[model samples]
Target chain A: MKKVRIGAGSGYAGDRIEPAIELLEKGNIDYLVFEALAERTIARENLDKLKDSSKGFNPLLEERMMRSLPIAKKKGIPIITNMGAANPESAGELICKIGEKLGLNNLKIAVIIGDDVMETINGYNTNLLETDEPLHTIEDKIESANAYLGADIIAKALTLGPDVVITGRVGDPSLFLAPMMHALNWSYDDYDKIGQGSVIGHLMECAGQITGGYFADPGYKDVPNLERLGFPICEVYEDGKAFITKVEASGGTVTTATCKEQMLYEIHDPSEYITPDCVVDFTNVTFKEVAKDKVEVIGGRAKPRTSTYKVSIGYRNGFIGEGQMSYGGPGAVSRAKLAGDIVKKRLSLRNVRTNHLQVDYIGIASLHQEASDWLENEPYEVRLRVAGITPQYDDAVKIGQEVETLLTNGPYGGAGDFKSVREIIAVLSILLPRDMVKTDIVIKELN
Target chain B: MKLREIAHCRAGDKGNTSNISVIPYDENHYEYLKQNLTIETVKAAFKDIVQGDIVRYDLPNIHAFNFVLYDALGGGVTTTLSMDIHGKSLSSIMCNINLPDIRD
Candidate 1:
């Protein structure tokens, strides 16, 4: 049986890197995929690059690569990641530099660029994908724009047979799909196989999410050893059938329940889960518990994808101000509510202008507004959280500053009053015709 | 039993839209969820937050349903004043609806 075992390393930009070390050292995986970038993260990284040229890629790119690369190289496992984020070239260079330092001078690194359309952003703005609004309305405010490039470009980079591939703004699933496509020699037109590979990628893209990290509940869906949770690995057969399991002796279990939840995660339509690579269909997908901690995934099919690509545009929206204070023991909800009122009144008294503001007593209806009765009951401990957005940076600062004043004033047991204000980069989406952008692939050797 | 008792869920957001999938923990409960967890029920349950239309899609094989609520994320993850701007907690909240213990 020709099978490839690909392990998912990191889920988000700042996700735990230790688990990846565990995967590289013990997972016995052929390739490792790390999904690190979110829509706004790139814009933030781009801002960092503007401030300092060497700082644009994922801030932890070097540290993560520094930890995992040697082990990956030793195991002969290739690494694929979107940690390149806003700067794949720089990320690739940094990885090469790390390789050189590790005495792995024969390493080959591939950097996939051309996802960034900051200069060609004018290609968008004709219309928004989901709305009738013109994207050009905020044209000048646009700071960064990157298209979600497909898997084929990543497959192109794989053709060079690099030791590691770093990419910017590629689709999350595409990061994993590209490897399967390359290793299996599957064509883009292999809709069913591509969808199967993509489903595997989607499950692996979130890393621990499928491995019981976010799937725990006390007495209901209890996951063991969650504190030291392990990452996931998908063993994909040549026909695109796969099974998800974690590293041996590591924590977390992969059953039909975990696989089902992850399969549905972030998918809008099961019959036609759209991606640049394929229109995945998970409606008929079955998860059979073949063995303990292993489930065979079957019935993933696909149709052709659309000709257009989704471009995530990041722009300076406004600023955010937030502050939190805590109160404990009996009557904590009322005490926290009082503290929240005091800050709201204080902010108004200070005439802090803001587009919107909210004060919530954590642990009581903070998530489900108006629908929760927990707001009426008394909680053992209540943390007062006050946050707001304002067009002015100073005003954003004021919203949180007012809350921090509770340390001396307002509530008696007020503690942990923290304040912060920062610029917010808002993201929006627009569609671009497939022919408008050319996704370029470049391979670089360790220097 | 409440819907939460019958199902477990995970919520995901993109732009101003949110997709919350409700999967019945027991396959036997799928029929009840399909019957009661209607678009109207979801709309009314989340009427306070869901500012846009509600569209539901079925995943019969998986014994689940994906409810997409548009204009619900308060302006998406990048820009939202809500403490949970990602609406990550909305899934547990989605399970708060009523589910009949016995259905034919």
Candidate 2:
């Protein structure tokens, strides 16, 4: 059976880098992927790029490339990643520099561009998926509008024989699927094969997620060797059959439970799980523990893709101002409550204009809020957190300022005061005609 | 018995929406959970936080129920003031639901 052993390098931007290096060193993988971009990451990166010409890619791009490039080059394995964020061209150039620094020459790095549709998306006058409002509603606030590119273009880049493929705002699964499409000679119209490959991509995209990174619940759902949770490796066959596993020496377990959790993560309707390439029917997908650390994944189907590509639109929503103060010893909850009251009243007295505000006791009600009435007794310690959304940065800063005042303003034993104000680059979605978003690859090599 | 006794769940988010998957620890408990863990039940448990509609999708082959709650994350991770922005902790809250004990 023609099979591809693909290693998941990093799940998110700040994910641990050691696991990827570990995979390259010992996993004997044919391909490696680092799925690093999140919804708002590229939007923020766009702002960064506007500030500096050379900025905008993933901050960890240099470090990740410096670490993974040499190993990937030496092992004759191609790498794919969306660490490019808002700048694939720059990212590809940086990778070439890193390769040259490591004395590796002729590293063909393919950079897939054209995901940015901000200039042209306005013409569509599309209704935002979340609010059903026209794009013009938040026109001034729009920072980025990148279409989710599919595996087709990425597979084309692979044919150009790039040592590494870097892309911006591509569908997460497409990074994994492209390798399969290129190696297995799968056609774009082969929805079944593409669907199956997408399933593998989705499972591997989150790296350690399927290998027990997020599955631990102590006694209830105990996972072994969690401290050093191993990233996942998918052994995919030509026929679309695949098995999820990890290296023998690595920590974490790959079982049906872990796979099941990751398979449904962020998925609303299993049957209509939409990706740029196809609509996967995850309802039929099944996981069976065929071995200790191997779980076979089977039965993924798909329908033809829609004519539209999903575009993640990022806009400047507002500024979030937050402040936190800790109170300890007996009656801590009461003290925290009093501290919250003071902040709330102080904000009101100051006439701080806020779109929304929340006062929470960290140890008690921050997570579940009113939903968590199950706390039968008062906690010995609690951290009071005051946060609010405001249009102006100055207004947002007041929230934190008020919380910091609780230390000297009353509430005895209050310590560990913290405050921060951050601009919210909120993301919404819209569907764009697939053809309207052009995609082309730029190849970079050492001099 | 509590739902946590027989089932484990994982929560994930997309925008302001959140999806919680409930999978039974024991294969036998799947049927019991499917019957009792209704949309109404899940909605009741999450009434305070979730502000939109809830839909339950049953995957018989996998023996899991995927409950997707709309407008659940206080306007999603980016804008929401929720501490657990991704609604990752909602899975634990989901597991805390009360369930009728099933005798062997």
Candidate 3:
């Protein structure tokens, strides 16, 4: 069994190349995985921004990954990423174009589709998988539908001699794990090996989670070179075990505690971790800190999988607007809460019904308000957050403007920051039956 | 059935559709809750408390239930926004159910 070096890149807002380029230049990694596409970034932009016809911020992220290809090719490293937000094909085509411009004729780009058919799937009448309401009734038209593709499609693309694979709606971990399966030629049913690889992917998906980004170590704050955080690297073996490490002399530490914290992320039950390909039993897994920057992972095993694939459905419901204000003064907490009431009252008087409204003091409890009994004390500063969506775009816009009015004469609460409000798009997730979904992997030669 | 137990419960679909799995605070008693509680009963209990139409289904041999509440938010699908920009809490509309009296 040959040792394969896998590198995972942390996803951040905007394009970042220095970290990945540094890894390729030094580590001589076999595979590079980049995870992008956060819900917050997507929700702020317009739908057209996601489409191939547009070259918005997301395309810039793809371009950043594409820029690394020339350097990667020089080092003979293959790259895979989920930078494809709404259009993987366009992203792939754009990558191929960049490869051509770079004069790398051998670049093979594979585009994975079938994940974007959310609208088509919603129209069909099928057994109500969960909701008795026919899928069509739940959605008039799907705004966006993406399939959380597993490693198999990526493995298939890698086997086809593609230097790069671009995918939309792939699980963040799958982006990194697929390369391991392809490099090792690991069987899909190899439960232990698959589970181990999945664990590695999980750790690396959120790049900083395994590093010191969320480290509880008291000294983490003093870790050197915070500006240039080094991404994580996985040294995978053929026996379904891997040691997660980072660049030598990297600024962050990879202790057992850090690795354990990463494992707990987005995890519901450690015992029954589900993925498209396998059910990873995280409870059986063990971790050992072998060195300063290394953590050995073992004991991962797979369980039977469900017959269906989880689908993320985004629909065109209506327009929404949100505005926030900062309050500072005596009784700021009370003042902010009162301001929220005033805004709601004014909107209702105008026959403008908002879907939701919330007010919170920054230092006080915002999410778990009822649970936070300590918020009774007045705080120095409070943030008033208000949000609403309506079928009529005009109504949503009006509500957004009304929130800005709070800064003028509406409330004497305190000084606050107000800016132009934007439109809110609707997003929903629905599961598609297994038989109805099939993944196709094709390798296209760079022109 | 204290609301706190399931109040922060998070549910999401796995495959290609929107099948939701509500994460109860206690996984050990998930089976007991599922067996005794049907979609109708759960919906009826909280119907007046929350918005949206209740839709539920039973899986084969798996003692769990999945439910989707249609138009639960005031504005239906359009009303709900992403968690990033907007700080408004969307899950507050759901009335918490207490199950202390039915404990084994």
Candidate 4:
């Protein structure tokens, strides 16, 4: 039976590259996939790209490529990655440059583009998926618009047989799915197999997340040696039945429990798990531990692919100001509460208006506080945080200033007062017809 | 007893909405969760942060429930100023719901 092993290197843009190096050195893997694009990361990259023409790709692209490319090249392992945040073309060029600097010759690179749809989005009168607000309302503030591309674009890039495939704004799972489809010679119409590949992609997309990296909770759900967490490698069969495991002599475990947790990580609906490839049915999925550290995944059904592509649109959404001060020792909770109260009162008195204001005593009750919160014993230490949002940057700054004023007016032991204001770009989604988004691949081989 | 004692969860956010998947630690408690983990209760548990309706999707094969919180996360990941921006920490709160003893 023909089977292939693919290693999931970096989960997100800033994910550590050391584990990826371990995967290359120890894990005899055929392909390495690094999913580095996040929705907000790309938006921020677009803003930077606007400021400087060549500044849009993942900021750590050079460091990541420099660190991992040579090792992967020496191992003869092809890499598939989306480190191409907003600029895959430039990212490709940079990768070529890195390989040359490493004395690597005859290395082929593929840069997939056209996921960005900022220029051609004017044709549709689309409304925001979350708020029903018209896209026209925020037209002037629009930063970048990118449609989540699928595995097909990646499959096309793979046909050229490049050592590395880089892309921008593609679906997270597509990074893994493309390699499976390309190597397995699966067609676009193979819904059931595509669904299985999608599930495999999801499990492997987050790298360590499925292998007990993010699932540990101390005594409740204990994971050992998380400090030396190992990334995941998948053994995918030609039949679309795959098992997940970690590199040899690495930390983290892959069990049925871990697989189940990652299966529905960000999924909204199991029956209609929509992706550019197909609507995957995660309801019937099953995981079985046929061997130690290897759990076989099966039974992912799929429906027809959607006709439209979901475009992630970023727009300037105003500014946020936050200030925090700590109080310790006896009566710390009360002192923090008093500081919060004072800041709220001062902000109101000073007419420092904001769209929203959140006054939290961090240690006492910031994450979980409601009308039903029962007053417990006073905390030993507490941090008072006052965060506010406003249309004007100056008003946003006032929110933090109000909290700073509490240094003298607040109760005793107020220390570590700090404040910061930042411009925010809220993300919104709109579906555009598939025809509106086009994909093109450019390949470069080291000479 | 607390729901955390019987179940474990993972959460993710998109835009202003958040989705939390709650699965019982033991498969025997699947039916119990399906019956007890209602939308009303989940909404009440996250009343402070979740502003919109909570829609629950039942997955019997996996013995899990995916609760989608609409209009939550305070303008989603990019715009939210919360320390835990992705709402990755919110699912543990979902696990803290008070559940009736399974013996009943």
Off by over 4 Å in 4: A371-375
Candidate 2 displacement at residue A30 in angstroms? 0.7
Residue-wise lDDT of candidate 1 within A1-447, one digit each (tens)? 678888899999999998999988888888999899986899999888888877778888888988999999888888999888888988888888888888886889989988888887774547766566798888888888899999999888888878898988988999989888888888889888888888888888999999998898787799999888999989999987888898877888788889888988887877888888878888778889888888899888888888888888888988999999999997777889898999889888989888889887778867766766453556688889999999999999888878888888887888878888889898888878888877777778864
The Cα error of candidate 2 at residue A40, in Å, is 1.2
Model 3: per-residue Cα lDDT over B1-104, one tens digit each? 54334322223322212223343334455565665555665565545423555665432122233455453333323333433222123223222444554555
Q: DockQ each candidate and list the results.
A: 0.74, 0.91, 0.09, 0.64
Worst 10 residues of 2 chain A by lDDT: A372-381
Ranking by lDDT: 2, 4, 1, 3
DockQ value for model 3: 0.09
How does each model score on lDDT?
Answer: 0.85, 0.90, 0.63, 0.86
Ranking 2 against 3 by TM-score, winner: 2
Best by TM-score: 2
Tens-digit per-residue lDDT, A1-447, candidate 4? 668899999888889888899999998899999888887888899998999887799888899789888889887899998888888888898899899999998899999999999989874688888779888998888998999999999988888889999998988888888888888888889998899999899888889999888899877888878888999999988889898998866888888878888888888878998888899899898888888788989888899899999999988988999999999999888788888888888888888878888887787567655533546777678899999888899988998787787888778778999999999987888999999888898987788
Residues A404-433, model 2: lDDT tens digits: 887789589999999999999999999998
Clashing pairs in 4: none
Displacement of the residue A123 alpha carbon in candidate 3, Å:
3.4
**CAPRI-style docking class of model 2 based on DockQ:** high
- Assess candidate 4 and give its lDDT: 0.86
Worst 10 residues of 1 chain A by lDDT: A369-378
TM-score of 3: 0.76
State interface RMSD in Å for all models. Answer: 1.3, 0.7, 9.1, 1.7
